[model samples]
Target: MNKDDAELARFNALARDFWDPKGPMKPLHMLNPLRIDWIENQYGSLVDAEVLDIGCGGGLAAEAMAARGAVVTGLDGADKLLKAAQLHADDHQIQVDYQLGMAEDWAAANPGRYELVTCLEMLEHVPDPESVIAAISHALAPGGTAVLSTLNRTARGFLLGIVAAEYLLKWVEPGTHTYRKFIKPSELAEMCRRHGLEIKAVTGVRLNPLRALQPQPFELTQNDLAVNYFMSVRKPL
Candidate 1:
C-alpha cells in the first residue's frame, strides 16, 4: 500500500524540526499565515466549523485554524510528521486531532466529516491526486468548502519553484519536486468539478524570495498564477 511512499519518506525524514521556523520547513511557516488569512477572507471565520487539514505536516495551518475557533483535525500519512504535529499542538495547547494515515483511507472511513477541507502544497506530491480529491469530497460535508494550493505546471513554475527554490537558493532539498507532478489551474478545476466541487476563486500565491531569507509577509493575487496558486471549491448544497 504505497500511496506515494517517497513523499511520505521525504517528509518523515524532515519531521523532527518541522515546527522550527529556521529549519527546512521554514518556507511553510512563512506561507501559512497567508494561507490562513485567505481562508478566513474567503470562507469567513471558521468558528464552530469542522475543519480538516490534509497533509498537515507539523500543525502550522491546523493550529492557526484552531485559533480561529474551528474544531480541527490534522491528517498526515507519515508517522514522524504526525508525532511532530502532536508535540507542537501540545506545546501550544492547541486542540487539533492529529491523525496518522492515508488521506484516501481516512476519508473513506470518515465520510461527510468536515465543513472545510484544506490540502495545501500537497497535491503535487501524490501519485494519483484525483484519488485524493475524491477522498476529500467524501470527507467534506455537503455544502462544505474545499481549498487547495499547489505548484503550477508552467515554465515559470519550473524556473522558480524548481530552479530557484531547490537548486539556486537551496530553500528546499534537491529533487524535492518533479515538473511532471505540478498541476495547472485548469486541470485542478476540472478535477474538482468531477468530484462535485464548484470552483470559486483561483488566486496566485506569491512570496518574495527575500521573505524566505529576511522574514516578511507574502501576497495573494488573481493577476498571475504562473508558479504557485490556490483555488477555492464548494460542494453544492
Candidate 2:
C-alpha cells in the first residue's frame, strides 16, 4: 500500500469513537469549526459547491461541509474510517459521498471536477506529499479553491505538535505523525506554485497555552506559523 500502515492502523482503531467529542479525536472535533470558518472566509460560501475532501477521515470536515450545503465527496484510504463516516452521516441525515480511495486516483479519474478541495492534517502522513499536491491542483476546476492544513517542520512544531500532543499530554496516538514528513510553509508554497496553483493566503492556527486543555483553544491568526497552519490556493481560469 502507498499509505502509511501505522498511521492508517491508528486512525482505523479510532473509528468507533471518532465522533465522540471528548474521545481520542478531540483535537479534530475542536479544530473543525475553526477550519470551516477559515475555509468559508477564504473560498466564500460553500453552498452548492462541488467539494472534495482528501483524507477526509471519519468525515469530520466532510460532514461539516455537507451541513453547510456543499455537495461533498470525501476520499480516504481507510475502510473502517469511511464506514464510520457513512454511518455517522446517515444517522445525522447529512448527505455525503464518502469513498475509500486515493486522491491521486480520484484526480486522474475526474480532472477539473471540484470547485473546492480540502485536505487537512493529511499531507504529513504520506511519503509523496508533492504528488498529493499535484493531485489536488488537477482535481480543481478553473477558478476553484483548495484549502489545506498541516504541521510545519521545525523545532517548535516537533516539541508541541509531536512530543507535547502525543507523548506528554496523550492527546493523540504517539505515532500519529512523523516529524521528518512534516512540511514547512515554504516547501508547501513551492509545491502549490509548481503545480500551477496560486497561493491566496497562509494562516496560522494559534493555540493559547493557558487554555491548552480546554475544548476550544485554537484560533486562526496572521502570524505564528511555528506549528499548525492553513494555506488557501486558487486555480487560474
Candidate 3:
C-alpha cells in the first residue's frame, strides 16, 4: 500500500480506542474540557452556528460543539474513524453528520458554507498543508472563524510532543507523528494570511493531571517553545 493508505490503516486500527475514557488516550480525555473552553472562548458562541470539524476523529470535538448547540459536521478521511465517530454520535443520541473524505476535497465540494470551521490536530499530517489551508479558507463563510491546532516545528516541540509524549509516555502510537511535518506559528499565520484569513488569536495548549499539582503549560509566546499552538483566524467580511 502507498503511504496515505498505510497511514489510514494505522489510524483505523486506533479508532475504537480513541474515545475510551480509561484507554490509552487519557491525556486527550483530560484535555477535552480545556480544549472546549478554548474553542468556545475563541469563537465566541457556537449556539445555532453551523460548524465543521475537520479530521474529527471519534467525533470528540464535534460532540463537544454539538453539546454547545452547534450544528456540527464531522469529517474525516479514514472510513473506520468516520464509522466510529458516527456510532459514537448515535450512541450519545447527538446528531452529527460524519463524512468520509479528505478535508481539502470536501471543502472544495462545499465552499463558503460553514460559520465556524475547526481543523484541530490534523493539518500537519497532510502532504500539502498550504492547499489544506486554502481549502479551509474557501469553506468558511464571509466573516467566519476557523480554528486550527497543530504542533510547532522546534526542538522543544519535537522533544515534548514527539519524544516525550509519543515515545517516552507512549501516549500515541509509534510513528504516528513526524517532526519534519510540524509547522511553526509564523508559517501557519502566513498561510492564513495568504488564504484571505486574518490571524486573530494564537495560544498554547497546557495539559495537567487532575490533582494538587501545578499545571504543566505549553506557552505560545515564544514560537520556538510552543509544542502545540492553537490559532484563530477569520475570513474577511
Candidate 4:
C-alpha cells in the first residue's frame, strides 16, 4: 500500500477503540476537557455558529463544540472513524454532520461556509499540509476563525509526544507517530498567512503530571513553539 492507504489503514484499525474510554487513546480522551476549555476560551461561545472540525476522529472535539451550541460538522478521511463518530453522536442524541472525505476536498466543495474551522492534532498525518491549510482557509467565511493544535518539531515535543506518550505511557499505538512528519510553529504560521489567515494567538499547551491521566486546562504562554501548541488564526474581515 501507498502512504495514504497505509495511514488510512492505521486509522481504520484504531477506529474500534477510538471512542472507548478504556482504550489506548484514553490519554487523548482525558485531554478532552482541557481542549474544550481552551477552544471555548479562544473562540468564546459557539452559540448559533457554524463550526467545522477537520480530521475530527471519533467526534470528541466535535461533540464538545456541538454541546456549546454550535452547528458542528465533523469531517475525516477515515471512513470507520467517521462511522464511529456518527454512531456515538446518535447514541448521545446530539446532531453532528460526519463526512467521510479529506479536509481539502470538503473545503473545496463548500467554500466560505463555516464561521469557525478547527483542525486539531491532524496536520502531521497528512501528506500535503499546505494544501490542507489552504482548504481550511477556503472553507472559512471571510471573518471566520480557525483553531489549530499540533506537535512541534523539537526535542521536547519528540520526547513528550512520541517517546513519553507513545512509547512510555502507551497512550497510542506503536509506530503511530513519526518525528519526521512533525511540524514547527513557524511553518504552520507561515502556511496560515499564505492561505489568507492572520495568526492571532499562539499558545503552548502543557501536560501537568497530575493531569497527565486527564485533560487539564492549557495555559497561554509566550512560548508558542513548544511540545504542543494551539494557534488561533482568522481570515480577514
**Candidate 4, superposed: residue stretches over 4 Å from native:** 1-3, 210-224
Ten consecutive residues with minimal summed lDDT in candidate 1? 208-217
**lDDT (Cα, tens digit) per residue for candidate 1, span 146-205:** 999999999999998999888887778888899999999999999999988999899998
RMSD of 3: 2.9
Question: What are the models' TM-scores?
Answer: 0.95, 0.98, 0.90, 0.93
- Please give the distance, in angstroms, between residue 125's alpha carbon in candidate 4 and its true position after superposition: 0.2
**Ordering by TM-score:** 2, 1, 4, 3
Q: Which prediction has the highest lDDT against the true structure? A: 2
Cα RMSDs, all models: 1.5, 0.9, 2.9, 2.1
lDDT of 3 by residue, 1-237 (tens): 102666678788978897886566555666677677888988888899999898787888999999899999998888888888888888889999888887778888999999999988888787778887888998999999999989889888888788887788677777888899999999999999998999888887644335413333322242332788789999999
lDDT of 4 by residue, 50-142 (tens): 999998988999998898899999998889988988998899998999988877778879999999999888888877788889999999999
Judged by lDDT against the true structure, how good is candidate 2?
0.93
Candidate 3, position 196, lDDT? 93
TM-score of predicted structure 2: 0.98
- Cand. 4 Cα-lDDT: 0.84
lDDT, ranked from best to worst: 2, 1, 4, 3
